[model samples]
Target chain A: MPVMDKLKAVSGTAAIVGVAESDQIGRTPDKGPLELHAEAGRNALADAGIDKSEVDGVFTAGYSTYDVAEYLGITPHFTDSTSVGGSSFVIHIAHAIAAIQAGYCEVALITHGQTGRSDRARAGGNPGLPSAQYEVPYGIIGPPVAYSLAANRYMHQYGEDRTREAMANIAVSTRKWANMNEKAFFYDTPMSFDEYHDSRWISWPFHLPDCCLVTDAGAAIVITSAERAKSTRKGAVSILGAAEGHDHGILHQMPDLTRTWGRHSGPQALEMAGVTHDDLDLAMIYDSFTYTVLATLESLGFCGPGDGPDFVADQRTAPGGDFPLNTSGGGLSYTHPGMYGIFTVVEAVRQLRGETGQRQLDDCKLAMAHGTGGLLSSTGTVILGRD
Target chain B: MADGYNKPIPIPQPESDNYWEGTKAGELRLRHCDDCNQAYFYPRNICPECGNNNTSWIVASGNAKIHTFAIVHRPPHPGFMDDIPYVPAIVELEEGPKMATQIVNVEADPSKISIDMAVKVVFESITDEISLPKFEPA
Candidate 1:
């Protein structure tokens, strides 16, 4: 069979039965990374009303799946630790669905946790990696530097002044959504265009406001066969479609700075779901930086190249707008525990279940959660719908 | 070189040994595949394009143009503290493959740099065994 046909065969075969975030997400100085994982795993299992013993599969990013499985006291028959940065959780969802169809595992639990702010989880580097040899030696220090390079290319391709305005609009608009979400770290703090424009630069073309916060958090999701989801507590969100891919491992090797792998994955997953762009009620795109959202919008075929600035103008993605996006404040205003892909999935499932109180959309039947990891190197898209 | 010169050093693997030797001799090198008629970067044995093991080393002209750049205001490591605002860029070689390098002998200002600006390679010897490849405005 063709690759697309094989992907479509697994459509709606698995559903997300439960999703939860660790209590006290931001700034958990007391809890370690493993403790956060355990907490989230326990909470998600409860939300699904499924016994811990029923979990036959385990998945996690960052830490080894063996560690998470052992820590959670789960001898899962199937285990995966697909660590491709933040997109791992999103990819795990897709992998879990396929694994269930193959009878490799029935109930799969995916979890993520990091003490990014209080302890700075990701502080070291691997000297053996290609980045260390090539880019790191030339002062390509952190993610902001690599991401700013891409942003600079985008601005050069588009109008600089226009691009800056569009980025500011994203920051302010995402903050508006954050105001409605009480759990958001920036819930009480609102942002303005002036504030975004005036913020000091972390890397040129990227103000502090444009970057994601490095807070601590843990999130988990429970997936099982669609038939088993019928007995779950809440309405199961069907796994309509999903796809994961990458163009390069490092920033400089990217075929195009302004374009991401999402261009391929987004359309592929949407095709498998048999849905059009108009079918989506909300879009949960990763916001490691404001520029990420803009570039992703174009890459996902939501807009054309260089049209992102105009597409997001006038707070189009803000709450109560025509296009509801990042409804959970996103990583920009929400808690970003280093790896934020799980949170995007969590928010998508919540919106599909009408669990979002103030930020909930009316009759939200279908939603899309897109994740980008490692300086736009890795991309994963999951299209979810309510039964 | 300044004292306490703490910076990351490129360790050459077996496949990349020729490329590093070329850099140490102030020559930029790239891997080329005769099977696919293409040149690539980041030293590997197999041709990424054709998966052909029949590949050899070729000397790059060191002439290139800036594809993209970033002015890093915050340094990631203490070694880079002196250069508070540095320009790290990806330059497209005349051979087609791009490389990550620093733009030296220029101010770290957006107005002073741009995309597709022509540049030429310059070697900065950090140690006896390694000479980092850098670029400057043509």
Candidate 2:
């Protein structure tokens, strides 16, 4: 058997039994980060019909795993606090599968909550940290500044005018989805190409609308062995495959400005799942910035390099298009509370479960959720399916 | 760009002390691995290419090309507010490693700057202890 066949054994062994967000997303000044975690955890447990006491494995990012366990009132036999930026939660699902297979824990809960908007909290680093000393000193902090470097490079490699058009299309199309999603921050407001082009430049190559919203939100996921999932109230979405990787921590060190490790991880995930891009009914690629989606789509082999702008040119990824992407409005128009990875999974699970009210894709069976974190540094790709 | 030195100063680590020292002395230094026959930036003891501990410093030729960059209209640190619309970029050194630095001595405009444009190192003495390595069009 080939190496790819080895992953097939573990495929579909674990399933997501529950997925939920906090009571309120966007902005909630009353809720701290931990409280949002607990609210989402409570809702997810209720969704799974699993008692909080049943969760024996705890996985989270952006905070201490011990704190999450203490707040959730669970004593776990397994815990992983992998903090690879926004992609941590999606990576957690991959970790939960291995832990469950090892008999380390049967029930696992992965959670994320951040007060990015309410607290205005920025990810801190020690004074001696390389990023602080080198990258930050040059004013290359935050998503807009860091991500724009690559966006600029992408425009340089591709055509600048067409690339700008492609980016504007993402903002316009994604907002169209948000218009139908009452929970989306921009649900009431629609964006046009002229509006996106006219938005103020947060950084060159990135307009205000091109950046993700800084919202306060929380999301959670519960995973278990596929056998155990049979008894759950809501049918489980099988974790068909997952892969996580990073090429560099800082934006400058990235081998290619226009490409990411998504090139490697996306193929590995699809191969492990025994599925192809054609098999996916929905794609939940992280839209931290409009350029992120374009780069990721090309890296995932959905389109050829420098062809991203053309691929997304006419709002093809929007609702009522041939390829539906970011059906939950994505971080661009939806709520982005720091890490948007978990929400991608949440939205994918909802679409697979036929729970999305209006923006849902009909007959959505196979979905791929790709998460990009840091300065386009980390990536996690998870392929999911439902019977 | 600003009168006061309000921006952050690079805190030298044991691994990167020599690099900073070289910058202050008006020399851009890189870590060279004899085994791998390659040089890398943000100087550290271990060679990133081959994981070789037997490494030495070599002064860069001060020639590079713009790999990518962003004109930071919004300052991340309030200290950088005065330099609004400044260019922060990753320039690929002639020595083969990329480093984070500011593109100075040029207008911060799309028409003025581009990827693969030649640039050379220039030092800015921000404090008594540190001199930041900035780049300008060659």
TM-score of every model?
0.98, 0.98
Pairs of residues clashing in candidate 1: none
> What is the TM-score of chain A, computed separately for every candidate?
0.98, 0.98
Chain B TM-score, all predictions listed: 0.96, 0.96
Q: What is the TM-score of candidate 1?
A: 0.98
Model 2: residues with Cα > 4 Å off, grouped in runs? A121-124, B1-3
What is candidate 2's lDDT per residue for A286-370, written digit by digit as tens? 9999999999999999999999988897889888999899999999999999899999999999999999998978999999999
Model 2 chain B is weakest, by summed lDDT over 10 consecutive residues, at B1-10
- How much is the TM-score of the A chain of model 1? 0.98
Going through the candidates in the order shown, the clash numbers are 0, 0
> Candidate 1 on A8-91: residue-level lDDT in tens?
888998999999998878889999888899899999999999988999999998899889989988999999998889899999
